[model samples]
Target: MLDFFRQFISFIPPALVPLALLAIALLLVAPLGLFAFNFLAIKTLFEELRKIFQDIFKLIIPKKWDSAKTLIWLSVFSWAMSLPTRSFVQSFIAFCGWLLLIPGIHWLMHEEKKIKEFLTIEKILIAPWITGALICFFLFATPESLPGIMVISWPIVSAIIAALPKFIKSGPAYKVPDPPVRQDLIIMVLFNLLLSCWIQLCYSTQVWLAQYPSFQADDLTNSSFVVKTPSNESAVSQGFDILRQAETALKDSLQGQSWSQVERWLLNFDDRIRDLNEQIIDRLPPKAENAYWQVEGRVLPGEYNVQLFAVWKGPSSDNLGYHLAKTCQISQGVPVDRTPWQTLSPVGSASPNTQVDTATVSCEPVTKRIKGQPDMAQ
Candidate 1:
């Protein structure tokens, strides 16, 4: 069969052949699938299957099998089939499994209703099951698994389903309004739109939180939404790790350098930090922007103080934003009385002179909640 399909498609252009094959495949499957669904949906077959299952387990299955039970069973089976497999065949089978529910629901809705009496309570009873089945199918087939068009279609489909009940006529003689301009449907649609906006807002907020995790440290008390805020320690953990790594790099690079070399390196602190940022910035989340690390050095009486700050400009309680701080003190292993140049003999001389002392570095605990925004220029 595979060889025949390949030979049959060999006549078409390479670019169009895949599409042609897909069209052919669909054409072949559609009729068979329709027939299978119609056969399974026959009232006698459905009842017989239900009766066999219930009779075999009558002791454990006390309730009579109904539409709800059937829908629930189908949902569970579909989920189970999709959960453990990633193969194309298994995924297709799972897709077919959920589609079975559509025919089942359609059969139930038309089982006891006349064409004009669809607006009756009995017909309306199946609406929730349909809505639920759609929701479950979407949840089972996530955005990543589905095509872009399918993902975009879900919200519109959901809105249409929500408004379907409004079209249900209350009685046989009651006519739908001319032009169909009903206030209830208009309000329902507007509410659906508002609900969509709220959902989008929540998703955007989650993206912000992920990119700028430091925002989780903010005092959300004044905010209207009651969200579960992460602990201060957890929120700043990434910032602290960045600072600590930079401190270690600085110590390793300047460990054995002369005092003058140390001073010169600190003088180009901004350049060194920029290069270091380029090295480690890829570790951050893709959407993280305007977030970086800065290091500054101060020459004390006998020691060098280097303060590392992980600064990020993002949504926070204060619009100014926040930074995490870590201070490290670098000192000479032994007190140096002379410079590296002086410690060496004259250029022409062969005499060995006193050894030049190197700097030793140690950092303190990382601090959180330091106010003020970082200077982007520096």
Candidate 2:
């Protein structure tokens, strides 16, 4: 298991950094494009519930009070003060809203305490039940910041709405019964489904954060990163090399020319490189800690991969290590076959299929030589 975790940590996140970025990007962008789709689903469901409410009113109450007006007023009241009110004001308005909905309105109009007024014989059950269901559907959905009020408050209101009808109609001879378990169940399911979907939406949006790349630890700090950059090179050249290598690898791995593919590759590629960059620093002693790399994942124009860069400290790889790191690119350098984190081969080594086991224990960076001289490598 320890070996498993070590191996697991070695490459999956890094290998699929490009893919993961694409998956996350899709998660964010898809829902936005499909926002209207979910909205339409909610709207259709509410319309059906509203139709049911009106029909039920006609069946039970001969003198039907158009309660939809009251419902609208209640909603307006709930929203008006709900968002702006804070601390005491928030609580005060809520208390008044609760009052208007119950005894106060019933007394003002019907001249009866709400408890008794609501218990009147002619009151219907189905309409209120449906209304409660609708309210429940909408309530938990809202990602509003102070959703504390709605989260707890609306459930009570729903209970009241679902119950008032049956209570009013049932006489002492017949106690008001609970809303059918099936009806309650359906609403609960619908509410849960809505909650899941809404949460997914929020999750997608948050996933769109920009991915900044790191090259190396400062002259002294030993930060962890995946890809390292050549420190002595001009900043522009270092960035270019990282970008070029990432782009080339992506085109080769994916073997597709689509821009979408390229964009996704870059994200994952950079993440893996960052992982590699950090591992390099972890092994260094605190003093002249020089094995840090720049970390970046930039989207290329009309390309499917992001270019990544890493910088190293210490002796050059040519002198200290044998194989020179060669960037891979697909045909015409157009399509990206692999990304930054796609498992890399050891430089100056003969094996092409060496496994990139645990990142920390598997690989070590041989510092670049002081100059580009090949003789110094021996």
Candidate 3:
């Protein structure tokens, strides 16, 4: 009875798995949204939200409940929510520092008369800077560099721009006059243009980073074979062992060859690897089909790196009516190096929208090494 049920499930399309999971999630979460809409009546919710917004507005701008203060706070909140948590915290600290520092600087410079004007300008300029910084941070910065770059660069640039006018006016030029409002508007526009250019550079760097594939040594050391049944474990291991032998043979044959010669010999090397993979599959208890393997070789001055991929289909366990395909790859002919495995087609199905289930073990190389040791030569 169990076998019959498994057979029925094996016939289901692989694409349906994601749809089923999504359906389950919606089924679980729909009631919560409905509950908020039903038990908490829409009219009551809106009234409560309005009160909450009023309270927050009063807290941020305690003395003045004007449209300008409301707009400033709204911009701050919008910018804060767009950032990742760490960046958001740093931005908040910078914001508080800006609020305190601007007044202190004005007081020390005996420019208290212009403090209100400075506050108004700062609030107006800050919104656009925050918006531009966040846009660059998200679209340009890689996951590793996002927080540090955003935290360090953004606040410093903002402080410089805010203090620039005071610095110029304080200079001992024969009673330097306050620039016209037109000049202030021009400065703001120019600063925004400069920020836009900086963002363009960051985006260009990100594009360059995306062009090349990363190679890591750990990806090779930690590679594993995918086996759907316990009985197939030995077969998978044997296949890997055969692959290692073939890799060694290819390396020995191609050693000391120039790049041109290696390129010429690649076709022959691939044929040999394919033959060995077939032999490995033939030895397995379950009949293997749609079997294929690829060998990639790169020759350096003193050493060469080789990566291998082998994929084949075998009889599924009785529970699944369709065949099960096992696909795995290993890196050999070098001490430590790995290339990411590329899937040519969905492992077992051979064609799109097929019922066969694929079991894939993808290898990702980790490049870190111990202290005092040289990094793995990629």
Candidate 4:
């Protein structure tokens, strides 16, 4: 079932995913828009929403008088509905946002007992759940700064918002308190707007990085056989000579062999080359630590391709290593007639059968630092 949902989301364009998340964030905070327009209308809006939800859930769970609790549950319901549709990181941020609201809801519920007229609509509308959604959007937008922002700013801001009423009471109480004109409400709205801008910045950074990553040149070089060494001509020449010698020896040894015989002969030849490589590395200078050579070859009917890789620790103070690869190919050997003389006696053949014996050789060189080795020149 989860896989089916994932497949459905996969059909949506990659660029649309983040936009959809942003849309959801805006939708979650749509109540803030209403609160900004007229605080009284928010109360009416929530009253209607509460009644609708109570009717819908009446069949499952009995409706209670705790509207604040119901609003909190509805926030959780929003998170649950969005979680499965979003990516793992987005889902995690949404979950954290939900977690951040629990304390705020508990504080509001506790404060309702002390205050003579608890502003239920005002408190519920600007709850930590809404702020958490804004924070989640910021986190998804700017993943690099997520930990710092969440750890440093989140708790401090939440605490101030939770203790806002007490701070206001310590000053002077208006005959009729205006929630919108409150200092904490103003700060919260400004902070949320700033966070929205931060989200935009993060999204832009992500797009830039995706288009031009830090190590693009290095990635390209690694993908191809281009050599970085100062001198690759000598290595390439040597590889060609070595491949020519191997091909000459092989042709002489397996001139008239069948396909099975040819395969066995090539296997033995490979083993001999392996032993030779070990011997060659052993003769290298003592400074060449972790020195090794690798020889690989492929044989076609009348063609052969070979590659030799050489790697050794450099004599640099940092214990860096050097690596080089040379590939060579021999192709289109002349084919010779191998049928016995008596087989052609009935026809009294006068023409001597043609054979292909010639083979061509070519080599190319590549160089890079050995794995786990530092860059010596750098």
Candidate achieving the largest lDDT: 1
Q: Flag regions of model 1 displaced more than 4 Å.
A: 1-100, 106-126, 135-159, 168-183, 229-233, 282-287, 290-302, 335-353, 374-378
Which regions of candidate 3 are displaced past 4 Å?
1-191, 213-249, 252-378
Q: Which numbered prediction scores highest in TM-score against the true structure?
A: 1
User: Per-candidate TM vs. native?
Assistant: 0.56, 0.23, 0.22, 0.23
TM-score of candidate 2 versus the correct structure, residues matched by position: 0.23
Relative to the unseen true structure, what is the Cα RMSD of model 1? 22.5
Off by over 4 Å in 2: 1-94, 101-169, 172-184, 187-378
For every model shown, the clashing-pair count is 0, 58, 2, 6
Residue-level lDDT of model 1, residues 134-212, one tens digit each, is: 6546455575565333333445556677666456676634546445557756765676567666666776776777866
Worst 10 residues of 3 by lDDT: 212-221
Q: Candidates ranked by TM-score, best first? A: 1, 2, 4, 3
lDDT of 2 at 117: 52
**In lDDT terms, how accurate is model 4?**
0.50
User: Candidate 4, 186: how far from true, in Å?
Assistant: 68
Q: How far in Å is the alpha carbon of 278 misplaced in model 2?
A: 6.4
- Candidate 2's residue-wise lDDT over 233-300, tens digit each? 22222323443444444444555434444445445865765654455335433333233233333433
| Ordered list by lDDT, greatest first | 1, 4, 2, 3
Better of 1 and 2 by TM-score: 1
